[model samples]
Target: MKENQHLVHHDATTKTRHGQPSTSPTSIVFNAQPFGGGPGATLTAVMPYLRSRLKSLGPIALHYVGSSLTMDFQKLTETKWDGIHNVDLYTNPEIGKRKLVSLLQHLKPQLVVTAMDELVAAAAQAAGIPVVIIDLLLWFWPSISPNWRQAELVIAAEFYGVQERIISENLNNVATVPPLGPPARTTQDPSADVLLNFGGMINPLMPKQEYIAYSHLIYSAARRAIELRNAALPESQHAKLIVLVASFDVAQGIDPKDPEAARMVLPDEALKLMASSELTFCTAGLGNLYAAGAVANAVLLLPPLHEGHAIQTHLIQKAGVPVDAIEWHELTGRAPIDYYRDSLQVMDNVSKAQSEVIDSPQAQTALVGRMLAAMLRSASAGVSAEDPPLRTLIKEFGQDNGDAMAVQIMDVLEKVR
Candidate 1:
């Protein structure tokens, strides 16, 4: 694990503090999806487990590859990471890949661990670095990329259609892991009645104005729904809603002191808060759904915020899961299921699939109605089952396999070491 001083300074927001590069004997690079916080959160959650397993190697260098779109890199600041490389893959893929490859070549790491960032993993493999790709969205990949086929290992989160896709792809190197998210709470007391968490509320390809509108629509609807629900209860029994966002862009211009306004926090802190909440209302992201479901007592999914979100929301509903979802049709009046599939064709563009809803005058009104309905249903239904729908989601999708993934990475590192 030798470092090149010049490469260390190449657009690195976080770097080792040594006056001279150390000559550590082993190194690893952890790269995560630049767009969403979920992939990065999974990678970070696995690090502690991986780190403990690799401690015998004695001071191995850890490098993180991330982007500005997410707060993933911030979570690694307190960890034993030596360098953080922030690249702009969305604005310029070729240049980002070049920078990434150059960094990998300089570090010459023993292994590369990536979560949903196929391009980064591919860059590493092209540079002769062993790669581990974490497919958090394994449930919905219609086709496999050649880049994935070449990876040293693929750790996939198990879901309904996951095994079928893996079998179809003939991916011998793949390992089916459980749903990944924030670890469960041990002794935390319930803090909020309902938590409104919208994970990584930005898509690079989506227009900023459109995202602003979308975020506000969801936030306002959720807040109003909770308010209406609370109005029906005794003053002491009123349910509280706390809006959590990774960026202020999701809910801007509100007093930070306002309990109902959005408050920006790190991924881990947000999950910790989720564990203490009675109910979690979030977007239909695989990572978000799993993390919230695994920890919170009750979980209800909000509508699709992106194309990938649209697919996952539809799949969850199709699977006949008992969890409630504010579907795309309710908000957009676009029930043509094929529309979601067609959106997948242009999925690479990564824009909002429900443009009709975003542009509609009644979008916010519809969301309010749906959210209030869901809240009222939950309040009236009370606790019905021993194992809730959230648990059902966890049973259907695999359990948290962060530790298993860490062990696998450690095994690879041990072989190389």
Candidate 2:
């Protein structure tokens, strides 16, 4: 293993460093989804595992690529990463691909890893770099066709088991791995009555109205559940119900028509609410789910994708964690009140389920370590195992002999940059 050294600048806001850039051992991980919502949360969950795994090898570097919508790249750069590369792919895919390919060529990384996004992985492979694709998003949606079958290794969080199965069934070269849980808890328990968290930006992908309705349903169910529980308890034993909303957008407040909506709480205030909560209600996003689970709180997951509930619900069940899924119809009042009652019953099971699965930090650390190891192995072999055709083509046209090719590549790269 190489000694850890700072290869880039260090500022209070961002610490960018690398061990050394060489094909023998160095790896470059490009995380293309940097919007700080669902994809961002997923990255945060996996980062600790990735860092630990990479540290075992030598020095590792991470570069984030994508448009900065709601997230702050500086937040990620503060970690053990060499640098940040902002690639605007949403505006123009072709130009984005050209620039990304050029960047990979310039970096000459031994391994390249990315989450499940076709364009990014395609670009990396086109540059004659090996690739590892993480299918975290598959847990939320059924498998879709991806063009990059030549990836050296493919991994997915074992949510519903569908992602791994899909990889093996569709892409012979892929491997399935369990997702690392969210970052470990740092503070002592505050213990709230209920915790509510939401993610996915306010866009067509995850509509604002859907979030509003989702929030309303959880708040209504939680309040009702507490009332039912309190009614069964002695007056002295009854406690006030608490609701903590994490990563909610205040700018797009819940609709006034929904009288059942919970009051908005700031991200800073969530700790206090969580400390007070005996139960939690949130979406199935990786960050919020892990945080609640880590703290031993029972969760209610309302994922954004229509088909997501099946896999997410399955994972929660497999973990022996207390979780329940609410359909959109139930959230929007289209479903009967019995649906909400059933969800509340699920939350009622938190304490017993919490004890069954909530172990020490060792389990979490071990899981992360395994994931990182798999990711590193996939990345290191990215170039050689995946892109023989591209490499052969490039070799045929020697760098010094192809002025026209050089001009075309440069033109494409310049436009994207």
Candidate 3:
């Protein structure tokens, strides 16, 4: 994890680790940020990895955001720890005040892990919880991004950017966080399946019928492709595609090895899978983006509904997001049901929810099928001999060898006195 020379600006009165050392094994409560109204992969993926590494210090509590915590996050919280609590954060600060405050008091955390969620930070500070904010994968968010970019102190992924503007703007507070992703990759099987993941954007969408129809469409197209390929080549020589839709346990014909695997995938296992990938088709999320980059040499980034993703990808490309290695396309629509529903029959809700784009399931299926076809074609041919070395990624995210991030966290935490 490299850093810009001007990243950390120390005051005469404060030093990261020079001050009266805080007690060893200081407890912490990680904020389960629910920003942008979505389920948290950070909790399921990033935090667990951090927690395992950080446990040597002291007990850690996980504070989820929302009235109710379910899904993968809840399952993660079920793991034994110092504490496991849910609170209404960001979206409902006032609503969560009492609950959050009580939990902080109970856990007595020296640090409240925050991901540029100022609302949560402010609340924690108010409750006497020292806050350490970090940027998982986004920068230049219209409201939150710019502020974190300017914070007197914060951690960010170096690949996202040098934050050169911030350096020139303030000569101060910053730290470099290595690309947070899966574990290191082992040997990649040449026959490994191509990995396809769209994260939460694909699951628990609406109108079961529409989703099923779309699934059928994708399966038919893939089967057709397979049939044609087998017609020309032996069955053993056909391209293998491993599609992971977290929401759909059973795919029409695109069945994943395990639907629940996304929530429970081990870092080491995840890295190996990605490494074996011939190509990856996934959404632009902080966790998955970096994970995909860690292993896959080739990638196809699908746009999520949020404009924030656009901002993140565009800005990071300046530093070293491997934009040169990535092939960006906008041929398909958004990956949600609200939008996926557009490709379905003309229902009143669909008309009311929609305006211009005919975002029906059929259109999405058609586009996704074509996208899959493109990916499969690439997989069938095999990785290029001259494709730019994945060195850019090696620089951007560092090696996926182990939980080295834990050591980095220790470096920062010991100084949080």
Candidate 4:
């Protein structure tokens, strides 16, 4: 809270207003992990808002450390941090820590923000620096990393983390963050076709080979869906079947023969595509799924082979994602194409059957798909169970919270100052 007796100025490259220059009164360090695309994307989505808020309050220095060995940090170069470092956590943990600490001490930031990374969180707290930990995984409360437990503050997102976050919210220095991301597309052409998106699976929970196979299955299914749609209607009536791949998903094979069939886009681009999709079949990572429900008329999920896939899927579904949103067939091996082909019909039949059982006296919440229902229910319902929470969240946080995570961190920075 005391003023820094030691004068330190890291000239930020981000031009405040055209030719005008600004000096940061405080520094904030961000340790970002882009491995699964969730953390990195979340950070980027919120960074602009965070910067805007920080600038209004006063000049504040920004610094970033990309915890990836092979990822091109060039993607984030636009962030214009006073300083940026890319370190390999898996290969050289000690060196990475040392480099990170040195940068932290030099900047002497007012606070540090980490995306579910324990080591970086721990290091910052160890230095007596205030830390705001972002809990994207919604990890078990008791099982939460000790590093996160020590934060000056922790913000668990509303949807992907709402369940465990209830417990996290009560924990020392923790609170529930409104669903965080850029504005989603609301205008929908209900008649739009499907978007076969698997997210940027650059970091696969499953083996690379297996990931490719599963991705191929989805791609092939998407292609077939296009054909079926073309045949089912006149050529002029055919709908768009766009497949947005990850920047790193080069092996998914975008089918050069049909160059328009697929293409790789940045994380933000993928999110917009998913939100604007009419029907979406995407990998069930928290990052991808959270953005999928925005405006899509129908959304079915496929889980990447991950150890925590079951729990991650369970929590979201419990929040009222419906019995059909999660496509379990892909993981169980019935062929993903079948799930995509009759998905609409399948969802209608399944929802009615599930609802019937749900209304039965003998039914239990543990019914195989009890919590699940096909997302095919028309958007006419206006507000699904999940929608209210997000709707309330947006109202509570405003159209945006300047990147909910950063906004919260800035509060801490201001308080101590």
Best by lDDT: 1
Task: Score each candidate by Cα lDDT.
Answer: 0.69, 0.45, 0.47, 0.55
- How far off is residue 212 in model 1, in Å? 2.7
RMSD of each: 3.8, 17.5, 10.6, 10.4
Better of 1 and 2 by TM-score: 1
Worst 10 residues of 2 by lDDT: 388-397
Clash count per candidate: 2, 17, 11, 6
lDDT of 4 by residue, 1-417 (tens): 222332232222232233323454577878665556666666666677788877776667666666431133325325555455565454567976776677678778888887777778878888888888877655544356767767777777765455555564556667666665555445334445567776655542233444454565556545654565556556655557677655444433545356555665665566566665555666666556556544444666654344244455666557554534444432232333222224344334333433343354333222222112222233223334444222222343333433667778778778877
Off by over 4 Å in 2: 1-15, 18-27, 32-38, 45-60, 68-70, 73-78, 91-95, 137-148, 163-170, 182-192, 199-204, 207-276, 286-295, 302-305, 314-323, 331-417
lDDT tens per residue, model 1, 271-348: 777876667788777778777666776677876656677677667767886677766666666543443455435442
Better of 3 and 4 by TM-score: 4
lDDT, residue 161, candidate 4: 50
- lDDT of candidate 4 at residue 122, scale 0 to 100: 78
Ranking by TM-score: 1, 4, 3, 2
**TM-score of each predicted structure versus truth:** 0.85, 0.55, 0.65, 0.69
**Candidate 1 lDDT:** 0.69
